[model samples]
Target: MPGFVALTGPPAVGKTTLAAKLAAVHGAQVFRLREFAHDVRHRIDVDPALFATEDPLGWLPDRTVRVLLDSALGGRGRNGVTVLENLPGTIIQLRTISEIGRRLGLPVVVIELTASDAIVIGRSLVRRVCPACEPDLDADPHRPARAAAADSSTCATCGNPLRRRRCDGTARYELKLRRFRSRIPGIRREAATLDLPYQAVNATASPDDCLRRVVAALRSTQILPCLPADLPSALNGATP
Candidate 1:
């Protein structure tokens, strides 16, 4: 049977980080939407005559996800949990994505990361660079360097400041809410069908505490057959 776990929430809630930690513990494959977009962004260049647009989701992430889903289910040795990251935009779109998982017989679970608005706004103001091209800065993509020059808040290699990019206006926020609604139902549906619990995580807590909470949640739900020995260290505070 196919299986899926989505790490979702308003942007900058530490979904990406949590996803990584979960994947590490479960030995799962992580499919990050941003990474997928970044990898293929250059390949789909549009000409000026075609009335181009730079909407990251329009071409890259959406396409990449569809293709990835097809390939992952079609491929062999895909027994482990598959973590889908940064998936929340529109309600209809999210439902469509969840349906895809269901059609593939994937046991789906949704984990919504929650943090205070202050934390979200603060993190969103930080400028994070693309990790694949700027790994020297930091392995965590959300914490990119602020500058290329050596500074108090910058990476030594690239000097880029680590921060989250804030989206202007209520548009993005509204979109996020819609996505949440869409997945909330999917989570309930999955729980009813598979007899597995859905989870919500508070990422603002102490690293150890947060990991403990996640591990506890997973254990209480009986999602994991056995807790991994290294899970504690893996989820403890990531790179600064």
Candidate 2:
């Protein structure tokens, strides 16, 4: 069995981007919890009221766990690491993940990305998602090239128009951020109790810099074999 890496972070903190990069480096499959939530919502015709709650996972059916587990363990080939994004949001979900990890005989490493609330809010305002590539792009005023691309309403990767998710407004984003903040302590405690290798990476820097920090943290924990040779060149000298 291969190792398991799970990423958790507040909204707009670049969890998806980091997960994508890690998956690329390890030749792993990325499993996103939001995608699974969407499938469950569509299948069960979830109540709109559920969206208003701080805990959206509470509305999901029991079978949702099975789906998540299958995605994490089923299709991934032998010796293939799996990178999980925005998963195990609740204590119940975390416990379930612990069980699945044990059953699969894969050690789980959880990395949480942390950023100031102000930075998170600013990122939420200008962040755009590329549907085809499934990665979020920073389009803040400071990033001129990315901002220009976003202004032109084009995805740099797929040449499609960028998109804003429904939860992209100030009020909704703040509420979601609060919910994420409330869960952090509990998640950390659970991870410690489970004896999982957990670390918090600062996400206030550029994405490349943050990725370097994450890679370094993983290397320190011995979760990653080593930094990929091409990574330094790709990241403009980001060392492991």
Candidate 3:
């Protein structure tokens, strides 16, 4: 099916983790908001300071996002769902992506993954992104990302040392979470105005359970072509 499944939520909600899993199941193209911004800004000479941890999205204009999305959709073949991580965040972004979705004959479904502050803060302590796997101001959106644990020393995929994201620090993460909360209502309203389906998923459960909820929600919307056979009936059951 030709459609998009956009993921949105505060810090440590596991947007990337869920997106990766969903992309694997659907064989979908994946777009991370920061990486996409980095790619476009690099091409057009956007000021490096605009990407500062405190206000990464503050200076990113909707026009930039719209043009990039249009160009991206124009270049790619529509075959399966495109899993977007932490995208369509602002009202303008919501409106712009919906326009692209309409003009390009693709459906847009927004999925907001939610987790409590306690859970998110706890996750922040453990979440680590591999630098060698993905460079900051990332130019390559398709590069593989290696997820690492809090105490891990090296990247599992690339064998390079893993590092914590600067923005993942306590104060910065809390700031980003506040920004996410402030902007989401407007984004949700925009989705409603555009007649797009928006779903909120609680992500405090185990990763498999959380993924199941997301997959079930997407399946209910019928954006996917069919049920994914890879999903087991139960993670653990009696051995026969």
Candidate 4:
């Protein structure tokens, strides 16, 4: 059975970037839950007013779960792994994904990236997302070259013009942080019960540093294959 990894973290903590990096290194497919949610919202023809009255997840249609599960499990026979990005925020979602993994006979691992609330909020305030390349860049007061490019509203990766997402602002980010904090204990408990391989990587470091730590953790946990011979020597050192 091929391996599957589900990554969870607070908003602006770099979960998407880590998932993309892992997928590139392991030649895996990615299933991003945020994108799945958007697809669900569009497919169901949801009323815009409903979002004002209730939490989006509260009224999530059943088809959303089906589509996400199918995408996560559909290519089971393939050689490459599947990397689920930002899924299973709640214990219920975790249990559902766990049951699906067990039924499909796929080995599942969960990795959570963590950072201080201040760092998350600061990054959220400065981040510019690239829709085409799916990497987030710090727009100001960091990454001088990238910041300079971002000043012109161009993405460093794909040269596409960058735009601040609606949910990236202060009010929404605070809400996301609160939600993340509330879910941590339940996620930890459920992951323990399911006996899933779980690891937490500190995400307060530089992106390269965080990637090295995550790669080391994955290798140590046997979720990812061992590093290639030609890979960087820095990765071979203990995860910082």
Candidate 5:
């Protein structure tokens, strides 16, 4: 049997950050919403909203789902945990995903990370870009500064401009909050109904400290067999 872990939270609340860290520590493979959307986008000519409106079930086909389930269960010989970020699209579909995991005999854990609204706003403001096409500027050595300076450059990864045009920081923050509000209700509701244990993490603190707490939380619930004895210290301050 395999194991599945899902991370969900409000905007800029560190779901993805924790997912990355969790994947690193546990040697898990990540399957994020954006990456999943990207895969679907490459196959179909449709906007995000269009795709969402058309196939609310998920971006992938039924066949793809089966393949993914098999792979996640180690049927294909690729073995590791599956760390899903922004999964379980809506409240109604939560059980379906959980059921799949259960049928596959995978132990599933869900963690919700949160922070102050202000922290989310700040994170959205300076989010960086595709490193390849956005060349560095001598004046501003940092990535975000250089990206902002050469904002018009096309992304080497996607060939899209390094832009926040339609969904800049303010817009993204607003949309994120709106989406968060819409999603949290269902997340909480479904969590209450599920057999899987749910954990809430205050990621407003430093990532390292947050990770320590997260590991401890998982350990407390007996989700993991054991946590490493020598946990690393959190870098920077309590908040970033």
Candidate 6:
């Protein structure tokens, strides 16, 4: 059975980018948790009211999403890891995730990326992710990333049209940030109680540097066994 590595962080903390990079290196399965849940609910025609909240699928009963969660837990190969992005916030949601991991015979490790609120807010204001590639527009060497993202037609790396999610709006970003900050302490407590490996990485650097730091930290903690062999060159390629 494959284990799961779940990534959670404030808006614009680079979870999507890091997950994509790791997936490429390890042949890991990646899941955007809420998005997958939303699609599942939509297909089944569940209560429309659930879609009204910022995160509609996070609190759904495990029974409702058992098959979807199982598919996510099942990796491509024996050693492949499952990389989860945008993990739900809240102790109840955390417990639900743990239960799913337990039932699947997969260990779940939660990786929380931490950055200054100011940095996160600035990046949030600037970025609009590429739906296909999950590339970070904020990483472009351009000023006023929002304006750059708006002017751009497609992802520079993948040529996919850029899309703005609800959290791209300033008001929604602020709301999400506040909610995430408030829940961090409780999340840490609950994760500890669950005996889950919950780790935090400071991610306030250039994308390459931040990725390097994350890989280094996880290696030191022995949490991620399926790391890339050429870590220095692949992850630290742009570290300065």
Best by TM-score: 3
lDDT value for model 3? 0.72
Question: TM-scores across all candidates?
Answer: 0.61, 0.75, 0.80, 0.75, 0.66, 0.72
**Tens digits of per-residue lDDT for model 1, 1-240:** 335666666655666666666666657667765554445445666232232336532323444445544544444214656667765343333554566666765555666667777666565555465333454332223433335454655555554444433432346544544555556666556544555446877878754666556656655553343334464455785421
- Order the numbered candidates by TM-score, best leading: 3, 4, 2, 6, 5, 1
Q: What is the lDDT of residue 174 in candidate 4?
A: 84
Q: Write the per-residue lDDT of candidate 4 for residues 1-240, one digit (tens) a residue.
A: 366777888888987777666666655677765555555556566554433324633434334554556664666524656777776677877777788777777777888999999999988877765656543232211112243343567767667776666566677668878988899888988999999888888999987788888777777765566333214444676443
lDDT of 6 by residue, 36-112 (tens): 66566666655665434444322445444444556555553246566767674667667777887777676778889
Error of model 3, residue 90, in angstroms: 0.4
> Which runs of model 1 end up more than 4 angstroms from their true locations?
37-68, 72-77, 93-97, 126-151, 156-196, 231-240
* Lowest lDDT block of 10, candidate 2: 138-147
Write the residue-wise lDDT of candidate 5 on 35-87 in tens digits.
44445656655444433334422245434444444434444112545666765
- Candidate 3 vs 4: which has more TM-score: 3
Model 5 off-target regions past 4 Å?
40-78, 131-168, 226-240
Q: Give residue 232's lDDT in candidate 3 (0 to 100).
A: 50
Worst 10 residues of 5 by lDDT: 137-146
Q: Which runs of model 6 end up more than 4 angstroms from their true locations?
A: 42-71, 74-79, 129-154, 157-166, 221-223, 231-240
Candidate achieving the largest lDDT:
3
Candidate 3 RMSD computed on C-alpha atoms after optimal superposition onto the true structure? 5.0
Worst 10 residues of 1 by lDDT: 137-146
- Candidate 3 global TM-score: 0.80
Q: Which scores better on TM-score, 5 or 6?
A: 6
Clashing pairs in 2: none
172-216 per-residue lDDT for model 3 (tens digits): 778777888899998888888899989999999987788889877
